[model samples]
Target: MDLSRQRCRLWKELVLVASLLALGICQASGQIDINPDSLIGVETYRTRLVLENVTSDSQQNGPMFTGRESVLKTGDLHIRGSQLNDTGNYTVRVDAINGTQRATGWLKIQELEIPGISVNATSVVEDIDSVAAICYTNDTNVMWYVNSAPVSSNNRMTISPDTKTLIIQRIERFDSPLQCSIEIIPEIFGRSELIQLTVAYGPYGMTLTSMPNHLSGVVSAEIGTPVEMKCTAYSRPESQYRWFHNGSLLSFSGENISLPSLTWDQMGSYRCVVGNSVTQLTFYQRLQVQVPWRPKPAQKRVFTVSGSYVVVLIVVTVLGGVVFCATLIYILFKHYSTRTNRLI
Candidate 1:
């Protein structure tokens, strides 16, 4: 009788345990809830769902929820779906089985609006200051971006107060192609077609040369006497050539420059420098002037020898004549005297 009583107590305890397990299973399976029936202006909407335990007071463990490899939790579960063109309801189901119990939720989708913005100026003079206008299709608040950086009026940039346009006051740098983009915010989705700006700071090069190859002689020479120098130069920007004589500016006329009549002072190393606002180039040459030298006769020697030498020569000649005459006469007298003595 005692053994039968013990067996009956054991059976009652097993039945109670089985009933408690069944109740726990029902409590573990819960319901889910999501707010906002529909969503708008979003490419994809994330819907959060809350799961509440209806029967149980303690938490239960099971396999975590998933959607196409995306993890979903019990409470505050996020669901996402594709709505490329169609905007309508998207159903998200959460399958949980704890002794046969399951739950699901739903969300709605909508479309958003974007704005438009573009650049006006395409090409501009290089180095000098220029302006590019950023305009919006519907005259909305816009921002300016030059090569991907936001610019406000500083040393080299100026943005208009309205924010619809940007005026680049000075382009002190960058010689290559520059890109300007405009972004308009708010209701409209805006993007600018790239306005390629070509900054051209004109080509600059200069060449200097002498009209007639520079050498130590008369260049722009006269027929007989004075020597002159001519210098010429060529350049894209029409270079101005200044003739330098021993490092001093030599004045000239027209593009064909001419130095003053060459003198001993002007004869030295000469060079022609060609330059403009853009570039400077120089050509060098050596110059020398030649003049003949003739000596003058002595006036003092001509006057002193004129009378004295002539008188002295005449006197000597006259004296010799007189001496010869006297000699002849003496001879004749001697002969006559001798004859007289003989006759006596």
Candidate 2:
């Protein structure tokens, strides 16, 4: 009987522990659950609130908050045709059978206005003109981009205090297609149309080339041979060309000129003038066109024969003088020997 009483006491303690666990679980699950902590709202769009462990006695308090009935209790709050005025904090209180629970959420509505950009001039000369680009928007925060890269203030570029205007003291050709962008919401941005610039640049690096024959700025062509000349220069706008002969301008005006037949009259100084109307720059180059001097076939033969006869005559004279010197030496040695023998 004492053992049976001890077992009964243990059973009662187990029942009490199980009841306490049940109470703790009810308290924990009774807290309200909001599916999302924040939401982005747009006009004429629909949104629904998801709630857990809430009863029909629950009430939602916020701008434009509505509700519908569910099988278990009053269902989630439904917002139809949300607007900017409906953007605010929302609170829900539930009078559940277990206890009272509360939850709060946020709804943010975005402005759909886009930004614009304006420039003082549509075209400017590179390194010779200044430009002012302004971002037009209600928001003061702004950013600038050139060729799809971020722009920073330098010795020639500056940004306004509010960052709305960008001033370039000396614009370059690479700084084109400027764009201005602004952020309306986190990770949401609005950009303006691209502003393209027409930058006028130089006419430089003058060059003149000849077809068929050219040697160190001199054009050599046979008589009656056709010669073609081409001139080139680097410029933003294409360079204009003019040809001149012996300081007198020819009637031709282009990058290429042709001399149909080379003659003595064509053998003079030829000049090519390259100029740019936009940049107001000019370059000139001079090339001498000449027919090289060469002897006729008959004259060349006569000269070759004369040179050979002179060389042969010199060789024969040297050999004859050497023979005569040897003979004189032999005669002198014979006479000296005959005299010595007589004396002995």
Report per-prediction Cα RMSD to one decimal. Answer: 23.0, 15.5
Backbone collisions counted per model: 6, 0
Q: lDDT score, residue 70, model 1?
A: 30
Question: How displaced is residue 32 in candidate 2, in Å?
Answer: 11
TM-score of each: 0.35, 0.59
* TM-score for candidate 2, residues paired by index: 0.59
Q: Residue 125 CA error for candidate 1 (Å)?
A: 1.9
lDDT of 1 by residue, 166-198 (tens): 667554335223333333223423445445555
lDDT scores for all predictions? 0.45, 0.71
lDDT of 2 by residue, 1-344 (tens): 12112111111111111121333322224567666857775545555556565433322232322332121233355566655665656565543345555676666655545688999997787778999999998888888898789888889889898999999888888888888888766656678899999988778788899976678888878889998999998878788899999999998799998889888888789999998888788889988888775787764434445878988989999999999999999999999999999999
Model 1 residue 309 CA deviation in Å:
33
The Cα error of candidate 2 at residue 204, in Å, is 2.7
Where is the poorest 10-residue window by lDDT in model 2? 6-15
Model 1 residue 178 lDDT score: 34
Top-TM-score structure, candidate number: 2
